[model samples]
Target chain A: MATFMDVHRGMTGITDEQLREAHAADLAIQDEEGVSFEHAWADPDSGVVYCLSEAPSPDAVQRVHERAGHPASEIHPVPLAV
Target chain B: MATFMDVHRGMTGITDEQLREAHAADLAIQDEEGVSFEHAWADPDSGVVYCLSEAPSPDAVQRVHERAGHPASEIHPVPLAV
Candidate 1:
């Protein structure tokens, strides 16, 4: 599976706890799309949330997020990790 | 400790292997500054890298990255989590 980093912008004022809940919610439904969410991070001040996941394609990742009610503004493949 | 997400810009063309090496190198030296790097993600096409870490302050995180020779363009605190 390829790794992906999806970004959600304009989320200013969103708290970390809210992100955690959203992430969990996404994970709960992700299996339907073959996406596995690994981690999530957010910058409350900038309103940018990032999610790391492994999936067949970016679309799968996006579909998961979309279903979770927080669709990403951009999704990019992460070809490296450590 | 608080979590942080640091962004590195203008890293276009950097491969996954190179990032892995850099992340490992950072981990090797991070303890000196009291920073614990948890994970790293890079978008090769966008020349952007995101690192998740736990540290006393953003400065400590910046110091570690600077020492690793990959200074961050921005750093933000993450105050909430699941």
Candidate 2:
């Protein structure tokens, strides 16, 4: 089993290019920490981003995010009924 | 092993009481159709609701929503990395 973190973004202050850069930095941080980001999506209007990831625990997710300099807004446990 | 659908809601046209009623009705519709609603959450500000359900097919999810008289705004397939 793994824990996932849903990271929200404040897109109003950041440009699209900046967001991509941040995502790249975060991806590297997560990859180094052995966290697999299953999927991530952004709402253009809301500027919120939801990330689905597989990590040993929620703390690991936070560690990677902290290293990336963008901590998550909320983390939710994803337990699949399947 | 199963397909999951994320159902979105619109809160502007409805009240809290109305939303609860709709949820109850949707829950019943989904339950009768063999879809297990594993979890659900709502955002008070946006009036958007997200429902996670384990269903055999995406069409099954739509069927329940249609029966409940509130088809989802968007349904995304959830695949757990765990």
Candidate 3:
């Protein structure tokens, strides 16, 4: 399994409720894109949201963000500490 | 591919260098267990280290921690915002 953490910066204005709303809809998005969204979190002060997911390719991860209308700032490859 | 975020607490006294040292050793440990680690971060104040990784089972993830001398506090599947 390929595991990764994608973090986004400059989310200062977004609220957890708003993001959570987005997350509620995100399931369908993931289902449609063939990706599994495991969890998502945002720092209230820092305006950063971290997302973890499973996908065959990184492009699929990006596609989900694009469709959601919130462009990600840093979609880094988070190597798990196994 | 399945992504997960494992957060461990009670590390209040550990330093970044100390954790980084462990992380450096983690690669070889991962290779032996057939797990791939994407990244790890430690909170100096909170003593919490969050790790992201790819593995076939949750037990595999725990095995790495046991061998490393630090057990994980929480292992949650991170749903991707696809």
Task: Report clashes for each candidate as comma-separated counts.
Answer: 1, 0, 16
All models: lDDT? Answer: 0.86, 0.63, 0.68
Give the number of the best model, judged by TM-score.
1
Task: Kindly state the fnat score of candidate 2.
Answer: 0.00
True contacts kept of 1: 0.60
Kindly give the stretch of ten consecutive residues in candidate 2 chain B with the minimal lDDT sum. B73-82
Docking class of 1: medium
Residue pairs clashing in model 2 are none
DockQ, every prediction: 0.55, 0.08, 0.09
What's the residue-level lDDT of A33 in candidate 2?
Answer: 75
lDDT of 1 by residue, B9-53 (tens): 899988978998889888989999889999888889888888899
lDDT of 2: 0.63
Task: Write the candidate numbers in order of decreasing lDDT.
Answer: 1, 3, 2
Instruction: Provide the TM-score of the second chain in candidate 2.
Output: 0.74
